[model samples]
Target chain A: MTLLITVFAAVTVTIIWYKNAPDTSMQLGTLSLMFWGASIMWFVDAVVGYMEEGASFFMQDAAEMLNDLYLGLSVVALGLIIWLVILMIKDPHRVIRSLITGTNRQ
Target chain B: MACFLVPASEAVITTVAEKIIRSKEKNDDSNNASSVPKVRFSDKLGWLNKMLWGGSALLAFEHIWHGEVIPVFPFLTAVQNGETGEMLAEMGTAGVGMAVLVTLIWGGMLAASHVIENRKVDISSEEAGQ
Candidate 1:
């Protein structure tokens, strides 16, 4: 199931990039790398979850704690997505500059 | 829930407006004949917003790894003391929510302040140049 999702995410990203981004080697490479990195991180997270899956009652509680932590992080991520959209709309020029220069807003 | 986006949105708009106002102030103060220095306050606020956004993204990435996309390990079957789990869960959930709320407000404040300081910078530059 996890593998399937990972593949789906990667393919989706690829499709989006192919359709939206300019046909540049750098863009393609960057997209591929992003998917690969995300996949690897997801894999590690799943492993930890599975390992704790069959533990004792106390262990299960610990796993649950970890799971909650994960959920909280998701909220933060959603916040960021909102932030990014806001930034793009409110300051498109600045956003573009930041992206091109790789220098954070100072 | 729907209204939550308003404060943050307003902050960004106001900040940008302030920047424009400040720039205009500098331009009008032709007697000063000085280029406006980038305002420190606004710059700092920009940094704060970036940090908040970046932090949030990292948190989300962590969530995705754990929740929906990947579970590298087997499921945790061990159940700890039910009472303790319940307490910890409550605390964690609350803590996360609070952290996000605080950060959002902080970002808004920073943005608003930046706009004001940007104006100040414009005025000061004009004065100095004169």
Candidate 2:
């Protein structure tokens, strides 16, 4: 469940990142890389679980799946929060800087 | 249960490495006005750190929420429950695999950026008709 959520986030962000490749101000690349890294990690875990449990790996009960979904969404939210921090720090377009200094009044 | 420990450990090492490289890179290069923009080694390592640290932290949180990790002496429930062997196996396989895969992907990103930077140099040189 975490794997699916992260993979979906990764793919969506990657597509958006590529589409707006020249606009590096948002730091979408970093966000996408973070998700990709997570997706790869969870993918490895799923594979290892499958190896150990064989066909039973995918047969999770509703409770377990619900827990996984919550965890997955939390991971995605944390990733976004981290990305937001990076974006603000970088201030690639100097939006924050401008807001602080009041320089872009035009 | 303790699988995220592997990548967390790797993140710690790379964080130290980044500090060392950053110290080394404190030298000046602002004099060379015509050179291509250099991507600092410390910065690249920083990207790897971000990937590793962020993922490991979230995974740790997940484990904590699942009650696999605890705020106790042994720390890990697996260790307390005599499942240390299974925990170690998960760490060896899933944890190591994730760390390696993330590092490899970071390396690929580095290579791709290097190529793009070189392309910029080529375009500028073409403008200069060199």
lDDT leader:
2
Error of 2 at B66 (Å): 1.8
Per-residue lDDT value at A96 in model 1: 67
True A-B contacts kept by model 2: 0.48
> What residue runs in model 1 are displaced by over 4 Å at the alpha carbon?
A1-63, A72-106, B1-6, B25-130
TM-score of each: 0.26, 0.82
Candidate that would win on TM-score: 2
Which structure among the candidates has the greatest DockQ?
Answer: 2
- State the fraction of real interface contacts model 1 keeps: 0.00
Model 2, A21-62: lDDT tens per residue? 778779887788788777877888888889989999999999
Error of 1 at A98 (Å): 16
Tens digit per residue, CA lDDT, model 2, B1-130: 9988999999999999999888767754443454567788899998898778877877887798889999998999999999999999889889999999889989998999999988999998898895
Model-by-model DockQ, in order? 0.04, 0.54
Residue B56, model 1: Cα distance from true site in angstroms: 8.2
